[model samples]
Target: MTTQTYLVSGMSCGHCETAVRSELGAVPGVQQVEVSAATGRLTVTTDGSVDDATVIAAVDEAGYQAQRG
Candidate 1:
């Protein structure tokens, strides 16, 4: 398993976490998504190589911006 963490911006509430989680959870190979809106952090666990760009794009689709940390 591989785990990646990203610093997300513009998340301010539980809805933000839910939106981000939903989008990331749909990505191929993504096994889990953990997000904290208050901290603006997103952590994803995957079973294999999932491109960072893909993850970032998923976050964007959720209406936010993120960069791998």
Candidate 2:
């Protein structure tokens, strides 16, 4: 599996974190997702190379900004 971290912005509460998690968790090959509002960090585990654009799109869909860390 591959694990990666992202820096996400605009997550101000648990709901925001949940939304981001839900979006990322639904991506194909994603096995785990952890979003931290306190530090604007997102850690994801997947079975293969996940497209960076796809991850960005997921965060965008959740109403947040994200970039690879």
Clashes of each: 0, 0
| Tens digits of lDDT, candidate 2, 1-68 | 98889999999999999999999888998889989999999998888778778888999999999999
In terms of TM-score, the best-performing candidate is: 1
Against the reference, the lDDT scores of all candidates come to 0.95, 0.92
- How much is the lDDT of residue 45 in candidate 1? 95
Expressed as tens digits, the lDDT of each residue in 10-45 for candidate 1 is: 999999999999999999999999999999989999
RMSD values, in order shown: 0.6, 0.8
Model 2 alpha-carbon drift over 4 Å, by segment: none
Q: What 10-residue stretch in candidate 2 is worst by lDDT?
A: 45-54
**What TM-score does model 1 achieve against the real structure?**
0.96
Residue pairs in candidate 2 whose N, alpha carbon or C atoms collide under 3 angstroms: none
Supply candidate 1's per-residue lDDT for 51. Answer: 82
Using Cα atoms with residue i matched to residue i, what is each candidate's TM-score against the true structure? 0.96, 0.95
